[model samples]
Target: MNRDSIFISHATPQDNEFSIWLTSRLEMLGYKVWIDKEGLLGGERFWVTIQQAIQSSAKVLFVYSKNIVTNEGILKQGIENEIEYAKSIALQFHIQDYIIPLHIDDSPYNLAIGLPNINHIPFNNNWAEGLKILKKKLEKDSIPQIFDTSKSVMAEWYENEYISNCSIIPKTELFYTSWWSVSDLPKEFYMYQFSNEVQAKAIRNSNQTIPVSLMSNVLSTFDAKLSFVVNRDDENIELKPVHTYIYSLNDILYGFESDKFPQHRDVENHFKRLLYRVVSNFLIYKGLWRNEMSNKRLAYFLPKYEKIKKIDFTYPYSNRKKSKSILGKFESIGMWHYAVSIQPMLFPFVGFSLKSHILFTSDGFKIIDDDKKQHSYRRKKGKRFFNEEWRDLLLAFLQRLKDDNEEIKIKVSQEGLVMKMKEWPEMFWSEVGYNDPNSKMDLDKIEDYYEEITEESND
Candidate 1:
């Protein structure tokens, strides 16, 4: 019974997720948080324990939500009892601002019991923003923090109680990878020499249809007859092909044994860059819009054109199959487009992995340009997505790219040079089993409860 401890009062099951999240965050910041979860033993008196905890705690965090009130705006018996008891304790101890209300939903302040007069922290729209304000308030109150042992205690609790029991099982399971396996490529790599340094520099600086890695006075490409006209101001400049070389694709895919060219590591790096360019160009050719992220990485997104507005796919939900669109327009937040960033991998397997991203547009055409706003909106929109939802979204986007074919082919040049890859890489592993505590929980019930509460509050 530490006097500095913060006690959390929340409705069971309904507000469980938010309570756990808030508790974990406070504990990580070295604040001792007491939540009524796995605390009382069987047959123990719950109200008696709660009263004792409130008496000893410095502050009580009341998670004010619609769950704590009925349709008549009357407080539930259990929470009403707890809040009344906490108020009495505060008066007896002469504690100022003893109770802090964390408004996690759209519940009206006027309908809230023992919270109308008090300042409530907002978390309905943004949890992270609410956390920042809460932290400032906690600091102002000079809440005692046990910096040394708090982190270790939190880690121990997470391992022992947070995660469920698990055991390794001798069963095979198919693991889907983001990687797309490369199946075919051109055999020869050519080094094209230009007539002059200026022409070579112009070709290197300009965007080309074929994938290439450039050096001073030389350009390395897989296409033997790679030729492009560079437009500069009022002049059209064509780089002269003065020299050529025969380089093996196997040496690039598999490790090279020859010391005649650059270092194998350098060659591998250059080839990877070329492959990335190929993918980028191919996506652009397929009418996907590109946007650069805050970290300078380029991500390609499906545009809002009628041909590919929404990608439909089926996924496992509950114990049954469910169909949904991967990308579409929402009235609340405009259009959400499925985007992906790619990285070409050469070790263990020759493949390119696609990392998924979500991009937003106001009218389903022009993308929102502000990076900070984009990031915040993305976080808010994606927070409710389950693991299966994210996986299916990525899979659906990949299927859209593959169309009806088993492979996606990118033409490297007009000389019939093409790079072909499978839709997805095949992977398998021995599965480990775990008893998920939330496996039987009904998500639909939770959603319905939230919706009901919101409607009641609005009324």
Candidate 2:
């Protein structure tokens, strides 16, 4: 049976043209449509083919016209037969909308004869308006399952990979977690807990209802940013953290932990390979899986330059002028800066580097080297630096720095911008160097800058 098909039942010559046109339109929208002239081939029995087509179709479009009501039942017997069969099946299955009544010219008909109480889709001469109504009804009547989209891939991964790995599912309690990101919002939107729909609703909806479609789309966009597949059993959909290793195998660098430090070069490489897989997964999620950026690829783009070339990592530390495990370049471009950093290789803890590039836009930063791009979530229309996104990122940064955690860091240039964000009293004392009441990074300086910018804008 063709579940994605629609069967059209209509009277002769008068309705034939409309049926043909509707069939073409439905076919274009990815629906397999069946009409008498289209479905009936030379040798096939008419009634048998009609019955088969009706049985196969998920919906039936019964076209109504002045001729049907005005004529004696004998003239449109085939269409009447199709409607009777459809009505019987529809009633047996308790389906209310199996047959979609389509009408033109709003001709009055006593629907009590058949298709009683069923709503009609008015497709009167205006095909455009009719198509819109038809398309919406088709979509609403179709499958309830989530479509396979690039945006839903992460959610699917979270459901499959992440959920399958979990041994237990949490219930009846809210727990703070990270790793799963709700997209279309700032990165900080994921940094909270919710035990039920109410909590979820509370977080997003203060007074207005937050559209789940928008939330889902935005969240799917950041699925790669999610380091771990969110455990399905987790009542609150707790996002699991993506972990990396350093001087150890299975040592959780980002979320959870289990350390295994190996001394042998071959064993170390084995662990490094595993860690690279994790990073590669994230890179894929970030949409940056280019051949040039692959771990095995020996060549790397020179940080500030567009030039792609191989660089030697064998030079000894003290003898070389630039002898750091990590190499990076920062170049200013207009109000933004293009920054590229080559992280030191993991295995030998010596020379190999994974080159990554980032673009620091005026409002936020974006990772440009990977297939999955990660960006700072910033509000486009809002107060200069006092929006929720800014506060969330700032607070997350301050919390990390306050705890002396290596998980997060502040860029010097970006921190200067942060200092300027001190117009908000809550944010003022939280500035990096503002721990001391008397400090060089003064609150007054931020106030002065804020006033200057405000004055300039007003002028």
Candidate 3:
């Protein structure tokens, strides 16, 4: 997009695969990204070409690698080139310091803390988010300036088909997904299509032209999402609907009580929807691991119910996976009303006696009991109460609800049970239908690709 080109300073032997992947993605995005693979190919003086590109470019991107710090290759390449270029250009041109370094979470760019003024984005969590960071960086008006000797670097780059301006950081393959925040997407509208990493880029760019395909033109199929949201104002995950669900907090914890008013606007029905959701989701996960059945393409699961709770305030980056099993159970019930557990542990509907007990549990939770009254449950023992008889359980619960309050209007929506993925990236990454031959990609299309994925083997 720019007149200037980017030089990718990277280690050769160690990061060969990553370098290849980064170049392809950048090219697809229509950016001129320079890497050693494209630039230092021929017998042309290696140092001369490197210095020329550094001189002309508006930007220099260091795909910082641990290997780069340790190994040395031709013409002081990798991190060294990136740093040298930054110093030379910044001092001469009045540039705003466009020398950028990207790194994984563990390694902060400064060789020493609080130094290097090195601005980098975290690539550990999500690939799409990381790409977002780099795109903004490249577009900034504050790019480092050009040097005099670098005057014709841009011209030389184009003449030799050299990449310029943008350089992809290493490790893009592991973390990126086609999914992104709703507001972050390029097109306001997109279609529904099932995709994996190899073809995810194709799905994203399919919307660029009008006559993409039948599926691309259909409409967005993102789902309601479940994530630990730091900012409540994120576009895909809005707070307004959450606020509505939060208002129903009282009924969810205790029990739906009927009143002269709206009775939580039908809390029990909502609860039933949530329960169906949970059961179906559990099945989906089990199914994924056991069979090659493909999950239906679905849109983001926007929180229809927002839950507000007293905060126990469990920050993430802590071990919370075990408890997620129980929390997932709640989500299945469709109780989207989310809450941060004020206590480290909470058992919903707790009962030592047979009267009442917590039915749902999740990871990262604490139980809060402000009221000291212990709930004791007692019922007529029916010799007829059989485990296999589901009707009995249904009748008993219905009778209990009826007795609790006649005003309580309970109507579970009759909508067919539709279960999308119950888990996040883990579930998405887990291979499903790979064993099934039908799940493979079209053979004709695979032949058309420059490099098809391992999906062909599965077919």
Predicted structure with the largest TM-score when compared to the true one: 1
Colliding pairs, model 1 = none
The full ranking of all candidates by TM-score, starting with the best, is 1, 3, 2
For each candidate, the alpha-carbon lDDT, in order, equals 0.70, 0.40, 0.34
> Which of the predicted structures, 1 or 3, would earn the higher TM-score when compared with the native?
1
lDDT of 1: 0.70
How would you encode candidate 3's per-residue C-alpha lDDT over 1-459 as one tens digit per residue? 243666566655554434444444344444565566443343333666677777766666665545555433333443565567567776788666456665533444545222257666654343334555765576565443232433333335433442222223333122211121111111111223233332323432432322122221121211222121223345332211111122232444455556642244444333333333332233233221111111322211112122322212121243532211111223322221111111111133211111111221122232222121111000111212232222222222222222123321212112221222211111122222221112111111112222322232134
lDDT of 2 by residue, 1-459 (tens): 335567888766566546655654455445566677633212333798888888877788888777564345343566678888988877777765898878754566564275546788876544434556777787788722222334432234334533355424444322221121111112211222234434443333321211111121111111113222233355434332222113322331223333542224433344334333333333333223232333455221112223322222221222532212112333322122212222324333322232233232222222244232212211111112222223233223222222134222111111121101111112111112211122111111223333443343356
Q: For every model in order, what is the number of clashing pairs?
A: 0, 13, 50
Best by lDDT: 1
What TM-score, computed on C-alpha atoms, does each candidate reach? Answer: 0.76, 0.30, 0.31
Please write out the lDDT profile of model 1 over residues 1-459, one tens digit for every residue.
458888898877677767767776677667788777653211333778788888878889999899888767788787888889989988987889999999988778976555899999988766666776787788788988764544555446555654534334456544566777778878776666677767776765664656676666667677776655788798887766676655676777667666764557656766777788787888888778888887788988877777444454443222544454656875466788778888888866777877888889887778888776687667656666655566677776665666465458888876768888666454545475333244222121233434443353356
TM-score, predicted candidate 1 vs. hidden true structure: 0.76
